[model samples]
Target: MEVFVEPQEGSPFCIRIGCSDTVLEIKAKIEKHRGIPVYRQTLVFDNETLDDELDVEGCNILDGSRVWLIVAPEPPQSAKIELCVGTLPSVMRLPIEVQVNDPVKRLREVVRSLEDVSLERVKLYADGTELEDGRRICDYELQDNSSVDVRIKPPKFMVMVLPWKADLKVAVEVKQLDKVKVLRKELEKLQPSLELDLPSEGYFFIHNQSGMDEDKSFQWHGVEMGDTIEVFRGTISR
Candidate 1:
């Protein structure tokens, strides 16, 4: 008689076997057809998991009967490690369990899942060094109970714009990914009354007392919240 094996993820397939065939024998036939290991395959009939030692007839499995096949995922090769993740300046730390071989990117994903934050904006650090996504946890020599820092990247932040000749300072809001050119435009829009010709007057932006690249983003220049961006009456050649 033929029994239908319906996998959790894919279409069902037929497996021809005798009624006296044991569940283990049926699983062997499935492995031959599906290439799924017998140990990883769980067969369910009539909402009950079938025992490997029981015969198909004893389990009341007849021809055209549908048997649900659940394939288990591969087990982790390495032992699980516990790490404490805490946000900056926050005393509360959350314990996260992960495989030692798991990548730093996976750690960030775990944090994002538990916290109310986006995965792309999540940053993880260990031992004063920022973790790279492609590198594994073992690469950082992170041991069990090691503390990891989680910082959420802010979408928008404020920056102080200081004019070179004038003592007046204007606060402008900008995104972390905004380029220096965008910042200049934002400044112009915020104070339209000011007679500032950033483009025509050859005006440029400065950060940390150094001229900033107009094409570079605020994140590239490491501009933080309330950081001063000095405006000078000059143009950058490059």
Candidate 2:
């Protein structure tokens, strides 16, 4: 008998098999035709998930009948490794259990969740070496119960400053905790090197599309990394 298997994704295809063939045999044929692993396939007939041991005829699956094929997601890593994560300054040690293949960023997220600290402020290190965000824990060759250090560092971001009537655009590094006025001073300090004719603090105002308040910190204004701050030679009237 020939059966039509409709996958959750992609076009439906037909498979020719014996009526007495088991569902597992049908899955094997599908693996041969589609290269999808048999274990990842879940076949549903008449709104029921077919057991692997059930035969096509026993399930009342007739020739040309349509069956739904659902591809299960990849299972999580089963091998869990424990690590001793310590936070600096406070010297708080936390025991974290994570999959061996988990990314370093995932570890940081776990720490952030357990400690209730901002993910941006969290940094993980092992043996004084900073763990990169992109690499997996297994890539570091870290074994079970390895000692990892977490540090809370103030996050800083760079902003592009386009001076009024000038061709040069300077990139200034600023911290989230710094007030908006501090951005002006940092730009002023670069006046000699960049040959920019920026007016003194009060005379000129920085605009991020809208006029930014000098008294407010960058965090308060929702200024993020790589944002552009335009400088205009005019004061914002209250």
Candidate 3:
């Protein structure tokens, strides 16, 4: 059986385990290797999570069956550690849980979009069978070593037009503490609160700020000078 598993950022990408192993064991393995937060991670099979005190067998993962463990990204919104205080726009996160013998479920979390954000609402199967209930499944059995692609819609915002003198092109990556601050300052120009778009993920990380507070919402995320970020830019006159 060929199983493909996708773990979110700061997560273990792939692994193989016997049906005999419990979900707890999987968590232990992740901690031993990756040291991920146990509480922050969720083990999902057929794209669903097991409820509290729920056993892996409840989901009925068969021999050679594949499972996905998703570690949700932490909300970027945080109060400033500096003396300044401010609020950032809230990002949305949706958790999905499904039961065995049930149809497949798709979870969607949208920051600015209202729709569920799924390319396909229904999960179709031709050979054996399929079952689902309001994003919950309890009966349809999944094939061992199978693969399912889960996609969440990316948050959309308006493009930022910086009047800065530097000739900026599309930058795929940005690294440097000072550089991030310089970019955030440009965002501040737009309105002390603007979002930037990146060509890719895992762009950068910032060390904690001890003196800042009001700018709490303004996290110092690494930004390449060329990467494009979207903002509302508010309504424009016709």
Better of 1 and 3 by TM-score: 1
- Model 3 per-residue lDDT tens digits across residues 1-238: 2234457554335455545556665665665656664444577777678543444566686655666767644322331111111112222333323223232333112211334444443233313233222322212223332322333333332223332232442222223333333444444454323334432322222223222222223324433333343322222232
TM-score ranking of the models? 2, 1, 3
Model 2 lDDT tens row, 115-212: 78789889999877788775568755677889898888765689888887877678899887789999878977888888887765545555566788
Backbone clash count, each prediction separately: 0, 0, 30
Ordered from best to worst lDDT, the candidate numbers read 1, 2, 3
TM-score of each: 0.38, 0.40, 0.26
lDDT-wise, the better of 2 and 3 is 2
Tell me the deviation in Å of residue 6 in model 3: 1.7
Predicted structure 3: clash tally: 30
Give lDDT: candidate 2, residue 207. 54
